[model samples]
Target: MRRGENLRSEDYMLIDPFINGVAEFHDRHRDMRLDVDNMSYEELLALEERMGNVSTGLSEETIMKSMQQRKYFSIAEESPSSLEPCCICREEYVTGDDIGTLDCGHDFHTNCIKQWLTQKNLCPICKMTGLGT
Candidate 1:
């Protein structure tokens, strides 16, 4: 949560979707053996268009802004009957643990959900868009 703080392996694991997506994209294009250095202007434009169609291009700044907009709370601040473990880590939320409540109404650890949104702008549970298009 602070500058220069070390993140756990779980944090990296949360971003596996994006990493795997890129790998899969490369795998799909392996046979083409496209050479970027030799691409013409038109070919570059066409490639950019195709990539735009494939991904939303969500960036780190966009993800941080979205995360900041969400409401943060502790488990003790909510009713006991409504308490639930974070779906990302499958861990119970302690009273003092920081939680983020997304617009979709799902709650998760602030760090856990932030990492997820950075890779994909969808709620981990419902696949609903969590950030503005």
Candidate 2:
């Protein structure tokens, strides 16, 4: 069957409620993930993948150890200067301003940045990976 063209009434009746429940559950527990101190390395990684959030409860020691084990690592840019202002807007940085940094080392004002990412997965500056910024 073609994608999304085989749904039956019963499917909606069953799936909609489950989807709503899961959404509600996520909204309620969104900030309540298990702390890194309480989580094994495996558990922490699994939670990270499941929620796609940066865990804050981990200690620097544990974080270093986990990295030594190849458990987790950051893709954050080396420094803010490693990147340039967004190409989409062709603007320069202003002091004490709001900005968003992407995984690819690009920065932009949050409002303009999101619209660009929504349209494509490329850096507004270099058109590299478009996961964030």
Collision count for each candidate, in order: 0, 2
Q: Write the per-residue lDDT of candidate 1 for residues 11-56, one digit (tens) a residue.
A: 7656574765543334766787879899999999999988785554
- Summed over model 1, clashes come to 0
**Runs off by more than 4 Å, candidate 2:** 1-85
TM-score of each: 0.46, 0.32
Write candidate 2's Cα lDDT for 1-133 as tens digits: 3576988866665667665454334466768755689778888788778878553233333322322111122235545565556466766555555566566655566546556655555665776764521
lDDT of 2 at 42: 88
The ten-residue window of minimal lDDT in model 1 covers 67-76
Considering only N, C-alpha and C atoms within 3 Å, which residue pairs clash in candidate 1? none
RMSD of each: 23.4, 18.8
Identify the candidate with maximal TM-score.
1
Q: How close is candidate 2 to the true structure, as a TM-score?
A: 0.32
